[model samples]
Target chain A: MSSKPESDHDVVVAGGGAGGIGAALGAAKAGARVLLVEKYGFLGGAATSSNVLAYCGFYKQGPEPVKVVGGVADLVLDEIKGLGLGCEPFRSPTTDNWIILLEPETVKLALDRVLDAHGVQVLLHTRVAAVSRTADRLQAVTLAGMEGRWRVAAEAFVDATGDANLALIAGLPCRTGDDAGYLQAATGPIRVGGRDRSVPIDRARIVAAFKEYNWTGAHPTARQDGGIFAEVPVAGDMWWMMYDHELVDLTSKSFTQAEMAARSAAGDYVKVLRERVPGFENAFLLQTGPQIGIRESRHPPARYELTGEDLLSGRRRPDGIARAAWPMEDHSVPGRPVYRSIGGEGFADIPLDCLRALGLENLYYAGRTIGADAAAYASIRVMGTAFATGEAAGTAAAGPDDRIEGTAT
Target chain B: MWRKSGRFQSLAHATAGEMPAKRSCPGISRDIALLLLFATDDLAAESVAGTCNSEAVSHHGLERDFCSSVILSLPIPIMCGAISAIQGHVLGLRR
Candidate 1:
């Protein structure tokens, strides 16, 4: 109507992960016309496609006490439950809900249905190649898809790319690194069947092997948890092994190295599972994750940087959006223990302030791109919490705001 | 106080109390299977030690027309530890 050929929407959400769904749905529900751009043909990104094995933090409620990550999160979960999807129950202490086993095709169709029902405009097989901005506000996003290159205009934008790919391209200040500038090892989640669960611990044999090999840190099935791997079964027959570290940098060298490292690490993971984990002895690797799990990346600049202290104190900011309870699960890339934080029996709530991308007006981030210090990033980066954060961020983006709450305006 | 109906049975107790259900066994149910996606925080730490299960999400999201609701229990620490740790970690130090 305005003589502009570009597609128009009040809110444009990039990425099709759990957070993207929540953001799009929230904006739509708040009466904002939304356009959801996904690089893949389907939604659910790492969640359903990657066969993530479990829902990390979608809600604090179900038949159990999982968080109520309302909006689209609840919508997706409903479909999973109603359809008898492959979702299975996890035994986290606070919640007792099913982690969808992630049958990729089923999830894709279901997510499509959910989005269509919500009246969201969908652009699949499209990747956002560039962003157009005016001063501090975003104007349009140019994406490359099969139909040819096109532009989408929006008043507000939500960068839900798990790695914040678009925001980083838009020149937003972000951070990515680990203790040694080496991120946690990423694993290709494999789905194998016919695992020999009845295999005895063979404590003597394993201890003998450990003693002989002197494999302390960064080996298969050799955990620093004193041989207590009870929670590993949360994945059902499917299990994961850390393969390679995804180094997040824009240089061409980074890309080549990342791909090679991922493949090499993945190959090593398969070998270790074959040689180490007892139940996995008969298990051949079935599949690798579609999305290589990214533990650290360009954390979008926000109004507040969630810190390790916030996690320790359990401080609930007035503008709190959702909650997180996973530990600082730092993956050690060989030569050391994948040191988990000194965990405590407490939970952290994500404040609304954490959603605001710094120095940018009307543009926010979700998923692993939100503003959090490196230490706090480990815990807040769970899938369930990512969904919740997106839910809240979407809701906030949908609603009108004078200034970001919980921080200096 | 409400009992989950017809989901499954407990294999063993964890720490002389309720044991976290193991998925490897057939004992796990559909509703319980869904809880891995959620966590509850409204109740005070001492008020309820119940784990928030995804049964509700799955029941309402995907299985509303097909799967049945299940009954189960898990340690409350997964939420508490996760929530508490994140909260403590975020609030304790400067971002």
Candidate 2:
């Protein structure tokens, strides 16, 4: 691939995670010439690359689960199910939250098909190195990838980079973590297979064995409540194990170290499982995620900063673009995780203003990079919510100013 | 933030599965109990400062603006006492 002149498009989406996919598909459906740029070859960001195989935030809390997230998110789930690659909603024994289990490979394929059907052009293995902005509006983005550096112009831009990379590069205001900059812990998931198909997993026995083997990195909440563990059965006899790498810096140097540490920790966990746990005698390690899963990072200033109070109160907005039903799942601490219920039958509304960057008129953001307090971010950062935000941003970015309802709050 | 207050901090820490020592505050406890007893259904705050603003006109036909006014019009101490009372109730603390 060679660098080309300033190519133009209606909406240029940076990052190809759930948000980016949703944005691209939404923009294309709105009849916009859309271009999606991703740093990796695959479509799903943490869902595929980091092997976070569970999709949450789609249903309301309480005994009777109500599906709140619709639109593109519902479409994705339906498509995955239609392909026979998705499992029925797995209701947590402790939290009563419903998590839809997905196969990463199938998810990627479904996303590819969706984007293709919607006529969204995708550029894989592409990274946005620099952004060009004229005052409050983003003009173009300079991308650096395997081929070379290239500049692409767009009428509007969507930053779904998970870290708000494009917004930061454009000199836009963004906040990371708290005033103390304490971010959530990261995890590198590992896939294991060849376990006994009929054997039931005993949570108590697993916790006891983990303690006996001195597995320090295992989440204490998972050991106690038996639901915080990222491990979920993906396909027949295969499970995705999300081992936490606590308090990791997202920089290249620290990321490399975290990956190495996670790999070692995962190996140790596998050994303990095979030796101590039942039905794991013939278990084998399948694969580790290509990248470590980041739970929290830079949050760009948006029109409305969703707060914990709003989520807990189950606030609803007329201009709401998405509904977040997941609890405040704080993975900030390694062992002691915090899970606060949203406390209502109806879901928490994600207002449209949260998707728009505070000082930028044309630049929008979705996924983990959207403006929110630390506690609110924990609940809305799930894949289902990410897709809804992405769809909202993409829809607003496709047309003229008439589409967006309100000004910055 | 209310969460940073010493009182609320203790409450939050307790909710995180911690066991906090019992502290007695009869005056505050009485005020909270009165507020809870007299608090009308209309005294529900819709949007506070630093919280996401809701555009909901009403809940079951009850005006949200009236709710906001009712909550905001209350005395500061009463509001604090009410919050503390609710926190204590959630945490299952008697005092």
DockQ of each: 0.02, 0.01
How many backbone collisions does model 2 have? 0
Instruction: Give candidate 1's error at residue A187 in angstroms.
Output: 3.0
Relative to the true structure, candidate 1 reaches a TM of: 0.67
Model 2 reproduces a share of the real contacts of: 0.00
- Tens-digit lDDT track of model 2 for A1-409: 2547678998999999988987887677556889999999989988899878778877777677566666666667767877776556777665568877767888898888878877899999988899888777999989887879988899899999999999989987667776578888887667777678678766676677766655465332233432244345446645545366665455788778878887787777777678887888988877788887888878888888889888998886545566777899887776456789885555676776788889888988877777788888989899877887787678667744432111111
Q: What fraction of native interface contacts does model 1 preserve?
A: 0.00
**lDDT tens readout by residue for model 1, B1-95:** 00111111110011011223334224654333333222223223442212222232332354432222232133443333222222222221221
Write model 2 residue lDDT over B10-73, tens digit each, in one string: 3222211122221222323322233232121222243232111232212113244443443355
Q: Residues A1-409, candidate 1: write the lDDT tens digits.
A: 1233687787889998877887787666546778889998788877655556566543332345444344456677677656656355455322233343445555677778888888889888888888998778888888888877778888788999877788887888666664345555444455554457676434444444444344543434333222311223334454443334445554557656655655555455545445775765766656666655555555667888788888767665434566665555555543232323322334566666678777777788777777787677876776666776776666556544322112110
Kindly report which residue stretches of model 2 are placed more than 4 angstroms away from their true locations once superposed: A1-3, A215-234, A240-242, A402-409, B1-95
lDDT of 2 at A95: 57
Residue B3 of candidate 1: its Cα lDDT?
13
